[model samples]
Target chain A: MPMNPSLLDNPKSDRIRRVADLANAKARRRSGRVLVEGPQSVREAVAHVPDAVSDLYVLSESEGADTEERSPTLAAIVDRAEQCDSIYIHRASEAVMHRISPNAQGIAAVVDMGALTSEESQVAWSDTPTIAAFWQVRDPGNAGAVIRAADAAGCDAVIFVDDCVDRFNPKVVRSTAGSLFHIPVLTMGADEMLAWCSAHGIAVVAADIYGTPGNAPRTLPDMLADRVAVGQSKAVLFGNEARGLPRQLLERVDRIVTIPIYGKAESLNLATSAAVMLFSLAMSSHMGRM
Target chain B: MPMNPSLLDNPKSDRIRRVADLANAKARRRSGRVLVEGPQSVREAVAHVPDAVSDLYVLSESEGADTEERSPTLAAIVDRAEQCDSIYIHRASEAVMHRISPNAQGIAAVVDMGALTSEESQVAWSDTPTIAAFWQVRDPGNAGAVIRAADAAGCDAVIFVDDCVDRFNPKVVRSTAGSLFHIPVLTMGADEMLAWCSAHGIAVVAADIYGTPGNAPRTLPDMLADRVAVGQSKAVLFGNEARGLPRQLLERVDRIVTIPIYGKAESLNLATSAAVMLFSLAMSSHMGRM
Candidate 1:
């Protein structure tokens, strides 16, 4: 973790331009890397997925000269990256760091997308594995928030089913607040998600306010009280932010459940709904009938 | 219910300028009015708090010349506004609409701030009345989202204790998605909140991750299982988004409870946490012991 002494003062340099370009999807794909900004995100990437992080950038004490790390927060991340043994540390000027990421807060990391892009290999699950899946969740912020909520609920994995936003998007990464490093996030087609769940003996529950005709939705509270269903290995699937789940997708799920609007709110947004439904089931299963 | 034939094509007119100025707090205070943007908020304002609305501005079909309402959504809101005989309906050009509110999706309203500023009078409570209160919630978006979440949870009211974001802020009203009109939102100082709850015989439950010394935080699940607490009149108080509740504030509350994090994800944001905790408690209270 020896710091590179060269001060990256030129924001228009080729290296700086390439790093800034990672904000775009095309550049990320072409370079096979990601720019993880902010101290929390950078630290999480270096700690949880050390193999994925290739470079660490810290803002220097001076404006254009590379001196010491500007803040204790940035220094701590640099120290943590040293223990990882693979991360290359670099100190850049404030302007350079700002150009790298406006949300970076004096620290940023370049991580290999190879480790993040591929799907995790199937593994033997616990007796009652809980997985969170999303279908057509297009908003990066919503996608990240749901992933964080799923992680907090102790889900085994997060599956993005069909036409979802890319997981490596910077806004998604920032909004996840480091939870992206804690769980395996994979992408699959709607059919593939159903088939995968079936092969693994996991029930697929659609978190929809309204189910297709003849398949009315059950309130989340009712589903929680079903001890057998609560204790079973299952995947809770959420819908898009606005349109919600299509009838075709709803018909394939094992159960359609909704978080009841006890008051006058027409509906909860995607992120809030996911947090409530996932945590409710998780807590119910963990705490038993209580 | 008749539509005004005069078209408002001038964005720079004194009337248009005054309506647009409501975006600022000073202007709102001086004029005693607020700018409500988008169809959902305008519709809700007309439906639930008709007396507060003074003017309705709908985007016209043409660019520079005011014409008929351009979209069915805007037309629906305009129709609803017409039902409120006191609400003066005005058609504005696209440029005028944009000047009033950038997010005004073809409709905006000027509502009297008088109806929105005062605290609600004390009311008799149900056996299991639940109230959601926030302390020092500054973020407009989070404030609105929590209001909506509280509404969804069937809370009796939303109390903005201490220094919280203005309830009439255009961003807050927009983020609420009409829930601001669905529930009674009041403001009070910290002392007032405590005194109000005590007078009403409502227990104050502080939702804090880290409880004060000698007062450990109880997990939400365990708290929910306590039937006596769930069925009693209670006020759940959440802290600031980042700093959380102060030690002094926590000491004054009846109980401190927390939502348990089961996975590596560190914590939930203010809006998400409010939704999860409020919905969990509401569902549990409504369904009894389950």
Candidate 2:
């Protein structure tokens, strides 16, 4: 483990302090940056929004183990860096990298704040675009898990609405299992999502556990039928696990979609529900193809 | 809080010590019961599989202060517990209950091992009751979440095969958010699942990250397409985040399903992926109705 001469000589630790506080929402938002620690998370940070990367630091050991060439994942980061010019692989010691992104896999990447995609792009749901949106979700882990689920379910994009956790939060990156990169995740106004849906002629389906009285809900299956028929894309929005979606959103959507609850526990986690609904939409489309 | 005179007068303090150890699997299996805590959880225990609930206890103060009478969510439990049954509901203290179940919600229900449902009532790929089998998933949270998702997806049953976490584990029950009653979960050997699938005409679709070569999928959508074919009901199996499905089982599956990975991470949590695949399969059957 080699230490950078500049830091060793100066005895300055402002950089380390800032990175330590990166876990909090306020610091993350204010810095216009988010920190990625660990080889796995750093690799994903690189893949998802390389352009958002403002600075890159590689622990001397991570650059290449003493005996080998650069690791493939690391090399991929270097390759992706060409787009944004913020990539750096240097001889900072493992200890130093850990100081910046502690518990990181001996590697760290400083990403710019624009990691979230523009919500407008997501609203233009192509006939085949699978999109998922989350609202008022409190848990960063759940939010991250859902993003990974959306990417897995083949949702074209995902959007986050009010009170959801910060997307770039380290916990979120970890939970995504790296699917955060492939899909565009836009954090924007609810009205923006509504407008985008209107423009694209896509339906805004709110997934609610409780349906309006006396009206039989076309199950998520029924909701997907419209998408399958026109070959239009669909977006499903999920709310907080505890309170569920606001009644306003529930009523506003094309229709309420619910996964049946048969057991004593009536609901699933926010992220899990998102996965279920998104998968339903995706499968419905594929079934149409068949 | 109130205490049962027989339990409190306790020459049986040793008994409490032994039961507390049931948090460990070996103790639970040997005892043929799992220790459960929490008011809502206990309620769920009573509501579903009441006979499986071998013992019941409550702090007297918990009776009125617990809001069970007021919380509609607790109604099912009260209704399920026959009035004549000798459930010890004590009103004197909450502290004692905490000793029994940490963070106990005023009540506790001890449950027997999970039961197995027959193939005739399961989800099979052909003209049979279709069910999904989750195999050797390590996380109790993931297991619980999957059960909730399976319930939502309308899978007839959910089975836990091989040596996975216990279904009734407290963490699992908490993760389920109350759907434990809706789905019938069976635990059996890998060979048992294979035999069940063969007999029921169910096509087993195994979700694997690396069933094919070269491309490491970054998102589930990439591989999930195979899980959603029309005209077939399927039982899907998923493994943990670090380890995927067992190779022997993966090889034996009729079709391999994958949720394509688009991000930098290698995979999603088992529950998220299960939800994606299960919902996809359910919607495939239901979309035509829509």
lDDT of 2 by residue, B45-100 (tens): 66555666666655443343434333443344544554426444332244555556
**Candidate 1, residue B290: lDDT:** 50
**Model 1 misses residue A108 by how many Å?**
1.5
lDDT of all predictions, in order shown?
A: 0.87, 0.63
| Candidate 1 local distance difference test against the native | 0.87
Question: Could you give candidate 1's per-residue lDDT for residues A54-95 as a string of tens digits?
Answer: 988888876443344356777778778877778888878878
lDDT score for residue B127 of model 1: 64
Assess candidate 1 and give its TM-score to the true structure: 0.96
Candidate 2: true interface contacts recovered: 0.48
At residue A149, candidate 2 shows an lDDT of 79
DockQ of each: 0.85, 0.36
For candidate 1, the share of real interface contacts preserved is: 0.85
Q: Quote the B-chain TM-score, candidate 1.
A: 0.95
Give a tens-digit lDDT track for model 2, residues A104-139: 665666777665544454333445665688887778
